[model samples]
Target: MVRQERAIRTRRAVVEAAAAVFAERGYTAATIAEILERAGVTKGALYFHFDSKEALARGVINAQISDDYWVPRELKLQEWVDIGMTLAHRIPKEVILLAGIRLSADIQGRSLFGSAWPAWTQLVTDKLVEAKARGEVLPHVTPRETAECFLGAWIGTQFMSEVVSDWTDLNDRISVLYNHVLPAIATPAALIRLDTAPDRGARVVEEVERQQRESPVPTEA
Candidate 1:
């Protein structure tokens, strides 16, 4: 059990190191040596988990969407809003998320490793579908199409923020985006009830963290 736990930690270290390097240098320029230095792990250890840089990049992309820290809302559309807002909050501070965003944007290395857009689109679509079933959205709203469009807007907004303010203003931009996008799809009742506050992501994250801090871990058997 100890050995398995160590392996898991080692793998996470390697993935996080690779994410940092990729976020800073892009995939083509990033090297295993830098990753090893960052991870404080051996070459053999990295190779054991990922045979090549492509594999490492794939691992980073895969790790982008995980058991994310979340706080659920009663409203499904609010839940959807929470998803975007949380991502907007984390992307600026989390190297893994930033690495995924950067890797997906780079056309040079994009074909070597596919982007996370499809997965994100699916996540958004699923939420929208739920919201629609709950009558939160307009009857004419299509979940998948709306998800795709929302993702496109999100990516564009992220890029613009990155260029303009190094993502210092991403939360506000994302909030603005939700406000504009929601009106078209959300029902009048839902729109009126939703919270698109720029600070929501931070609040949600804090609540989740507080829960984690208060939760008890299992005792050794």
Candidate 2:
């Protein structure tokens, strides 16, 4: 068990190190040696988890979407909003997500390893489908189409924010995105109830942490 846990930690470290390198230097320019130096792991350890740099980039992309920190909400639309806002909040801080964004935007790297957009689009599509089932979305809204459009807007917003404000205004840009897009797709009741505030991501994270702390731990019977 200890060895398995160690391996998991080692793999995670390698991925994160790779992310940092990839975020700083484009995939074409990034070197395995730099990732290893950043990871503080041996070559054999990195190779054991990832066969190549391409594999490492793929791992970084895969790690971009995780719901472990999220708490479920009664409103599916609000959950969707939380996902975007939380990502906006985290992107500037998290190397992995930043790397994913960088790789997805790199023409050469994207051609080689594929972009994370499809996965993100599918994630949003699934959430929108759930929201539609819950009657949170308008009747004319199509989940897949909406997801694709929203993701495109999100990517553009991130890029513009990065260029203009160095991502200092990403949360606000995402809030504005939601404000503009939601009114078109979300039901009036859902739109009214949803919190699209720029500071919502931080608040939601705090709330999730509070809930986790207040809830009793489960034990085997």
Candidate 3:
């Protein structure tokens, strides 16, 4: 049991190290030697935890998936949407690594979810479908398409923020998403509540800043 626990910790260390290094340097340029150094583990130890660098990269991506999305929150549609937007704020660094562009350059056997993206997307899509049925979404929009659009905008915004860190503030970006972007897709009834619909926006921003101070950077391995 002790050995199992230690192995879990070691694996986590490697993933967290990869996230930081990949975010810093990117996948194509990052190497096993660098990852091993960052992880403070020997190459043999890393191989013990993971079969190869490719497997380690998958671990990093898997860790992000485990961190990012969840269905058990059992939140209402708008609540789910808000949570999704809030978490989207954390995606840029993770996305770069997941795309195999920064840290997982050699990882190519499967997609991020390993045959489960559609399942996950369906879970989110279901919530949007419910929202639309309740007239929370605009009447003209289809639920699946609307969900895709919502995700696209969030991802695009995150990517742009990653590239032009100075041009965008995460807080301001989410506010714009809520006050401006959401209104475009929301029904008038939903739009009306934007003024006072429980400000998780502030909470999300505060959490990001808090994580920045406490963690200093991403750490998932």
Per TM-score, the best of the predicted structures is 1
Tens-digit lDDT string for candidate 1 (1-221): 87777888899999999999999998988999999999999988889899989899989999998756655677899988998998999998899999999898888887888888889999989999999999999999999999999999999999999999999999999999999999999989989899899999998899888887799566433
lDDT of 3 by residue, 1-221 (tens): 67787888888888877767666665556678888898898787789877865676667655654433332333245565555554544444354333433332233434431422343356557877777777777777676776666656655665566567832365456556656556667777776654323345445557556767887765443
Worst 10 residues of 3 by lDDT: 96-105
Worst 10 residues of 2 by lDDT: 212-221
Residue 126 displacement in candidate 1 (angstroms): 0.5
TM-score of each: 0.96, 0.94, 0.66
Which RMSD values do the candidates have, in order? 1.5, 2.5, 6.2
Q: Predict model 3's lDDT versus the native.
A: 0.59
Clashes of each: 0, 0, 6
- Whole-model Cα lDDT per candidate? 0.91, 0.90, 0.59
Query: How far does residue 118 in candidate 1 sit from its true spot (Å)?
Result: 0.6
Q: Which of the two candidates, 1 or 3, achieves a greater TM-score against the reference?
A: 1
The prediction achieving the highest lDDT against the true structure is 1
**TM-score, predicted candidate 2 vs. hidden true structure:** 0.94
Q: How do the candidates rank by lDDT, highest first?
A: 1, 2, 3
Tens-digit lDDT string for candidate 2 (15-95): 999999998888988999999999999999999999988999999988888885576889998889999999898888899
